[model samples]
Target: MLSRDRKWFLVIGIICAMIMTSISAWQPQTANAASPSASKVDAVLVVDVSNSMNTSDPGKIGNEAMKMFIDMLSTQNDKVGIVAYTDVVQREKALLNITSEADKQELKAFIDGLNRGAYTDTSVGVKEAIRILQDGKTAGHAPMIVMLADGNNDFNKTTGRTESQSEQDMAKAVAEAKNSGVPIYTIGLNADGKLNKNKLADIAQQTSGKSFITSSADDLPNILSEIFASNLKLKVVPLQSITANGNYQDVTVTVPNDSVLEANISIMSSKPVDARLIDPSGNTKPIPSSDVLLSKSKSYSLIKLLKPVAGDWKLQVKGVRQDQIDINLVFNYDLELKLDAPPAQSYKKGDSVQIRSYLTSNNQQFQDQELYANMNAVLKVKDLDSGTTNEVSLTNAGDAFTGSYTIPDEHDYELSVRAEEKSFYRETQPITISAKAGAGSGTNTGTTQTAAPAEKSNLLPLILAGLGLLVLLIAAFFIWKAVKKANRGFVGQIVLEIRDENTGEKTYPQYKKLNTFRGKFNLHQLLQLAPEFSGTDKVVFTPANQDRIMVRSTPEITIEKSGRAVDTGSGLELKNGDRLTIPLASVDKTILLEFISVNS
Candidate 1:
């Protein structure tokens, strides 16, 4: 019973709301977004599974150390892939994006399943690792390869490969890795005194990586820790060493600032140790709770705490009497170093370009004055043509560190800024800036430069943006309808396994056939198959195009596939053979699903 004008107004309001929603969807997320993404790491663990390792690592301690390395990865986006090789590639696992505890467990399981081959050829391992990184590397993630071998090359005479030929192949592979900016950290085990130390050192030096030779297999965890920290621009801080008297001993660890995103406290001991952690608030926190993970091996225990409070925390540990316990702390910070681009794209010789570097946390300016009190910053300039490098010191300038570099010559140069403190450091991505011949003396060095005034705003762009937003809204509506129509047909059955984490009880495998169901299949319907999944009735699965199923889950529920977290907010598609692990946090239960054969 509304009037015509009132109805028109209502229509206009609806249109405005749709346009606003479209604009919001397209806008970039701000600093307040949940858990801002950290700089990612893509690493390939290349271990030699040669028979010689049997004599060198009889305890198979290397596998345990590698597992610790996998557990030390603290971020959701960090990826790890495993490569085992001898004379040939014995096994290879693709880069697995670490998103949940399941992914870490999967990686550790792969390491455990490694079997030794009869011969050793380090080249095959290195090359296979490089290939995996080159193929599966995520853009913007720092790529690295850690190779562990006894530094021997033994090919069967019947295979028709010689040591000289193998050396040539290794040289080529190293060059390819170096050109691709992948550093190869080499670990040479010399337990048998036959390790070719020079060979490993040469490969490391050529790729700007580090080389370590350990006489004892037990020293692996520390070496791996060092390499991990060094690659991530972090430092390993050794805490106090203590002797266990069969009673609980207290150790204090200091987290310097709030910028630290993760702090992994590694306790090394020969004997098993039990640890209890006390937060700054004097509350005893659970060791294996969400946001805190404790990984224990035969030789060491790693407690990884996400977003640790910035204060003194205490760790109480009980170990065997007279056992020496060594503790180390590695911090992964969200802090980033930003180098502002120069005023001009190209400059002439003798013209000084001002370098401005600042630190950011969670994608905003980090205004912690105390953190910058003793921090030192430097500008690194590398000559692209001549291959020479030089560093220039920068002085603190309130919010940013400022320095000036006069274009010394007419060659193109790559520049990066590095800021460091006692605890951690950050370096900016290198940028190339060019300078042309002919200029005056470098008199503008260390001088202030004024910024140009902003121009007047225009209305045309705003009007076009509004029209674009409307078009986007209309297109999105149609796309939604299309997707809904595509997900209508019956798919197949899903074999389900439900586990109650609270009681550590699991239900037997159950099957839910989907041939009778049409339209979207939701968890409410799925619950009939498993009475134990009491509270997961909100998750929905729609049959997507091409025999796939699209998933939509409540925000509180976490969904992981093969080791990667599925962004259920945007929707995720699953095909046949896909396995999904859904953790119903509200009910303290988990559901595992396997997409089996499709119905005809």
Candidate 2:
């Protein structure tokens, strides 16, 4: 039993002790919950060993940057390998199964030993890197390629090939890597801005990777660290396989709205196959190949489309026999937001500026669907100098959202828009607003008008002259039409007959009046009208004023003129009685085109 004031103090002290104990118990739990689990990654470093790198990077900047990249990886679990290439490719280090401190030292030592070689063979390096990753990839590991190049593909001289040929080889390698679901990060160390930056950027874009161009070797370490620290992941869909039972197969895939779609098809058989894509709009386009850096392997074909329309896409495959094929379709849908405002270059203080934002979910405009109501949109304006920030909710404006902000002072401001709901989040690029103008200064009011009075004058002579010229033109058109009709009635005609290679069955012949066919005519279009060209890719025929017709096939197909194989790029001229043959893998008989002339 104590006094009244002492008793009250004792109770208060007990309550405070309980609160402190509760906080102490919760702190560790909160921190543990906030920490994210480490992700497993398999990365390959493809370094250029061309002779130019010796003079351009005598300090071995690439080696130092690579060592830094290796150290930046999370020690929890990430594997890495190294590939060095000049005129040939060599594996400097095998895949480090476990990323430990010891493994890092081993990889660094290998990088340090790299030296400049004869010429640059970028394709070999990329291909080797991809191969190593493919062999080392595990169930939960994501594969990545970090390529450093100081020059273009210059190894063709050693291989006895042209520069263009080497470029084609590199493109093929890139396509293969992309088809296999490996993203390539390209670094162009062009100190003089002479390297092919466009090509490097194209490779990265095709595979959903990034490109960095650095002018100084000193920046390599930081750049490499930044790239590695980024939690970039290539999200891919599950693989789908289909078996063809006939000469041709048509498969349709539904492309989601606002997504980047990549389709890879691999045919099991060794026979060459022709493939094409028909988009939702029913337009036919050839699949991009190694020449475009969209595909690498001959047996596998790759096609990529960004923000593809939401509809069915058709993939048409033509092969000689029924073959087992595998198709992998990968999609990445990220939120995209765009901000539109009056140019911020000149704005007066206290001016009210209207900011509008267009929000897209995975590249698709928001519609009145199941997910639209759950989205939350907000606009933020920050004063860079003062570090003051203001966030405002946006109102729905049908196709987009609308918001307003008044310029506060004469300081440069940064503007950004964010829209998020649940797992979906997207932010626009930060826009910089220049310093505001002084008070009472001229600002863009966007309100001005001008008008001119009408003038009247007489034009009877001008009207007569115009009518006379029209009349003369009409007369000349009639005379030309008469002459053309006369020539068509008497000119010679050429007959093109199509016969099945195995069946010897001939379809109805197409007759072209020689005088009327004196210009270029697309044979592909003509063949489409006939049943015999059901599986043909493309064909073109140009009938000259001279008594000969030039014929060419699509890049994918091979054509023979009078039993001699002709390069697809070069056209062959055929006179009367000359024959053209197109061999088919699936069909028993070759397609024979016989030309005959008949006088009208």
| Model 1 misplaced stretches (Cα beyond 4 Å) | 1-39, 438-600
Where's the lowest-lDDT run of ten residues in candidate 2?
Answer: 447-456
Predicted model with the maximum lDDT: 1
Clashes of each: 0, 8
Cα displacement (Å) at residue 179, model 2? 2.7
Instruction: Give each model's whole-structure lDDT.
Output: 0.77, 0.59
TM-score (C-alpha) between model 1 and the true structure? 0.69
lDDT of 2: 0.59
> How high is the lDDT of residue 554 in model 1?
76
Give the alpha carbon lDDT tens digit for every residue of 1-600 in model 2: 346787567555544554554445433221001112223578888888788776655555566556655654534467787888876764344466543455666577667656566767677788778867765566556788888886476654545866776678778888888898888898887755567888889888888778887755435433553454343222233344556665557777666554332222223233456677787899875566321113322334444454466778887777655565655444333435667644334566776667777655434565533344556778888998899898989876656667787877888778787765432345566676655555223343541211111111223343444455654654675577577545432223344456676677765445454455434555545455545555564666665334456677776666787578778567776654455777765555455564432210
Looking at model 2, residue 237 earns an lDDT score of 34
**Per-candidate TM vs. native?**
0.69, 0.34
How far off is residue 197 in model 2, in Å?
1.3
